[model samples]
Target: MAKRIIKAETVQITYREAIRKAICEAMHQDERVFLMGEDVGRYGGCYAVTKGLLKEFGPERIRDTPLSESGFTGAGIGAAIGGMRPIVELMTVNFSLLAMDQILNNAATIRHMSGNQFGVPLVIRMATGAGRQLAAQHSHSLEGWYAHIPGIKVLAPATLEDARGMLWTALDDPDPVLIFENVMLYNMEGELPANAGPVNIEKAAIRREGRDISLITYGGSLWKTLEAAEALAREGIKAEVIDLRTLRPLDDTTIIASVAKTRRAVIVDEGWRSGSLASEIVTRIVEQAFWRLDGPIARVCSEEVPIPYPQHLEQAAIPQAEKVVAAAKNLLSK
Candidate 1:
C-alpha cells in the first residue's frame, strides 16, 4: 500500500532517525504493524531511536513493556502468529540471551514444526557491538551466534539507506527477521538517497573494489574497513571492501566471487575471534576458493577478553582501523 519514494529530494539524517522513519512508514502502511519494547514508549528508547514515536503512534502501538526480555519476546512471537506484524526491540544483544528460548525454539521453528500451516512474521531489532565503554553488560556483539541457527534472517545495516530500508523489508518478510543495529552507529550522520527504499536483503555489497585483497566485514566494522582500504590505497595496495549486509544466509556467491578475484581476504568483525562470523566466512573461503588464495586468510576481531569499562581498555578490546590495515599488510606480505 506504500508508494515508492521520489528520488528528486535529498535529506541528511542520522542512523537512529532513519530506523525510526522506517518504523513509522511501516506502521502507516500496514494497520497490523506495531512496535513494543522496554521503555520504547515513554523513555524514547535506550538510544532515543523512538523519541517521538510514543506520542505519534500513541500508547496502543508504541507499547512500553516491563524489564523482562524473555516475557516481552515471547509475547511478540505469540502476537506475530496471531496475524500481527510485531517489531520487538531488545535494548542490547546481551539482553537477547534471556529470550533465546523464544527466539530459537519458538519464533524460528513454527513454520517447519507446523508443516507450513503457520509462520512467525516477527521483526526483532536490537543494538549490538562495543565502543561505548558500557562494559560487557551492554556492549557484546553476539549477532554471529544468532546466525548459527537454521531459521530467521540476520541483517546488519551500516548505512543510512540500509537503516531506513531494511526495516520495512524485514516487516514484509514472512518469517522471523532480526536486525542488529550497532550501538555506536546510532549517532552516525550521513546523507541518504532522496528516495532510498527497500534494498536487497539477500546479497553482499562491495563498497570499494580492488584486486589485491578483499576486506570482508559488516555492521559497524564496515567504516573501519573502508578507512583501512583508503589508507592502503595510498601505499598502492588496493583492497576491495565487501559489506555483508546479511549474516545468517551469508552471501556465499558474492563473497567467493570477491575472494576469487582478489585471491586474498581479511575479515574484520566486532565479535570474538574464536567461532565467530569472521571464522565462518574464512571457512567458506577455504572450502570454495581455496586455490584462489595467494596467502592465508587474515582476520581482525575483538580480543577474547570481556569488554572493559575503561575507555582505553575497551578500545583495545575492539577491532580498530590500525589493526585492519596491519592485517591487510600481513596478508599481502605473505
Candidate 2:
C-alpha cells in the first residue's frame, strides 16, 4: 500500500486551523480513524472545529449523529470496541450527562473489566466552562466530575498547541480520553509550533514564573490568572501561573514546586468552590507545602449557582480577571 501524506498547503490556515489540522492529521494517518457527533458533518460542529472535514474525508469518516446523546455515545463505544478509532464529539459536556452510563460505565470500564483484554480507543471532544451566556443547560465544567472516574484520561487544552496536539495523543492511546475545550478559548489566537511536538498526558505546564505567589489553574481560568498576574506586577508582586493540563494525572510535582518557592498559592477555577478540582489543588499544597506557607491558601472560583442567561449575570457567576486580582491581593495580605 502507498504511504499517505497530507499536503502542508491543505491546512485550514486560521486561529482554529490547528484543531482542524489535528483531526485531519489523525484521519489521514490512520484509516481506522473517523469522527461522529451531532452536527459534525454538514453543520461543521457547534464551533466549526470540524468544518470542511466531512467534505474532505466524506460522510462515512465524518458522521453527523442525531440528538440522541446516549444512543450515539453508546454507538461510539461499540465502534471503538470493534477495532475502529472514533472521535465522538458531544455538542457540549452538559449534554453528555444523558450519556453518562455509556461514558462513565461503559467506555471507562470496558478495559479494566475485561482484564485489559478489551479496550476502548475512543476520543470524546466536548465544549466546557461558562462564557457566551449559554445558561445552565448548555454550559457546565463537568471535566472535574469525569476526572473522578478511573480508566479514562481527562485533558484540558488551554493553548492552541494543546488544542491541536491533544487529539492525536488521545487517539493513539488504548483507552478512552476526554478533551475539554473551553468555549472562551476557541477563537483566541496564538502561534502554534510548525510541528506540534511530542505531548505528554501526565504532566502540567507552567505558563508563567514569579516568586510572590502561585496562581494555579487550567482551562478558561488560565487567561484570567495570567491577566491578574500582569496587574499584580505593578505592585511588585511576581505571580507564577501553572496550567494543570491533564486534570486526571494531577501533576502535583509542578504545582508543589511553584508553591514551595512562592510560599503562597491561589487556585482559580471556573467550577464552584466546594468539592472542586480547585479545592483538591489547595489541599495538595497544604499537605505538601504547609510549613512553607506565608499565608492562608486562597481560591477564586465560579459562584455556586446555575449559569444564567443574562450576559452580565453569567459574567458575574464565573471567575473574572478582577476577581483573580482581588484574590491574589487577599492572599498577599495574610
Candidate 3:
C-alpha cells in the first residue's frame, strides 16, 4: 500500500503561536472550555503561550491558580466530571509529579471506577524535556511515565500541525488526555494551514520514509531522529522515520509494518534507558516483527541520570542526532 499524505496551504508560524491559536480557537468554539493554571491570566502563562488570551477571554475563562499542582489539577478533574472541559497547565512535567495522585488515580480511573457513567474530559498541558539548562528538577521527560497508565491518553505534539490540532481532539475525548509540549520546541517555526484544526489522535505518522532502517521516536526527539535520517542519507543509507504521536496507544500497526519493511529498527527516546518508552517500543517490535528482522533492534536514549546542570553533560545525557545516526549505522552493519 502507498503511504498517506496530508496536503494543506500553510503559513509560517512558531510552535508557540500554533499552540496559542489552537487554545484561542477551542475557547471561542466551545463555551464549556476554559483554561486555568499558574501565571495563566495576569502573568500570561509560564511560557507565555497564554499571553493576551486573558484579555480576550476575560478572567472567568482564563484563571490563575496558586502553585498547588495537586489542588488545581484535582479541581480540573472535578470540573470535567461536572461537564466542563478544562485545559489545565501544570507549568512543567516535573511539577506534575505533585499532581500524580489526581492524574493517575482520579483523572485516569474515574470512568472505569464509576462504571462508565463518569468521564473526565480534561486536557492537561505541561512542558517536557531538557535543553534550557534548568537542571534536574525543572527539566525532565516524563511522558513515558504518564503513558504507562492505561486509562489516560498521552500525547506529545512534535510538529506545528500537531501543536495546532491535537488539543481540540483531546478535549473532545471522553477520558482524560495529557499533552506534553517539549520546551525546546516552543521556538521552532513551521508552516501551518490557516484553517488547520483537530487531527486524529489514533495512529502514528511516517514523517520520512525509507527501506534500510527505521528510526522511531516522538516529541523533541523527532527532530533529532529526522536530522540523523538526513545525515545517514548522505552516506547512501536510507532511513525511515516514524513519529509515535499518541504514545499510550503505541500504534503497533504502523510501527510493526515499518520495522517489517525495513528489516531493522532503532528506537529513540528522551527518557532514561531503564523502563523507558523506548524499551516498550523495542519489546513491541520484537514481539510482533521478530520474523521480519534482519538484525537486532537498537535504541538511543538519555543517559541514566538526573539530567545534569552543566551544558556539556546535559547535551551528552540526552539522545542527539549523532547518537541516533550511530545507532542506525550499527543496526545496518549487522
Go through the candidates in order and give the clash count of each.
0, 0, 0
TM-score of each: 0.97, 0.94, 0.97
- Give the Cα lDDT of each candidate: 0.94, 0.89, 0.95
lDDT of 2 by residue, 236-261 (tens): 89999999999987999999999999
| Model 3 per-residue lDDT at 114 | 86
Using lDDT as the measure, the top candidate is 3
Q: What TM-score should be assigned to candidate 3? A: 0.97
Which whole-number lDDT from 0 to 100 does residue 274 have in model 3? 95
Candidates 2 and 3: which is better by lDDT? 3
- Where model 2 places Cα greater than 4 Å from the true spot, the runs are 1-15
lDDT score, candidate 2, position 86: 94
lDDT of 3 by residue, 112-222 (tens): 988998999999999999999999998999999999999999999999999999999999998899999999999999788888989999999999999999999999999
Q: Could you arrange the candidates by lDDT from highest to lowest?
A: 3, 1, 2
Estimate the lDDT of model 1: 0.94
Poorly placed runs, candidate 1 (over 4 Å)? 1-7
Tell me the lDDT of candidate 2.
Answer: 0.89
lDDT of 1 at 246: 98
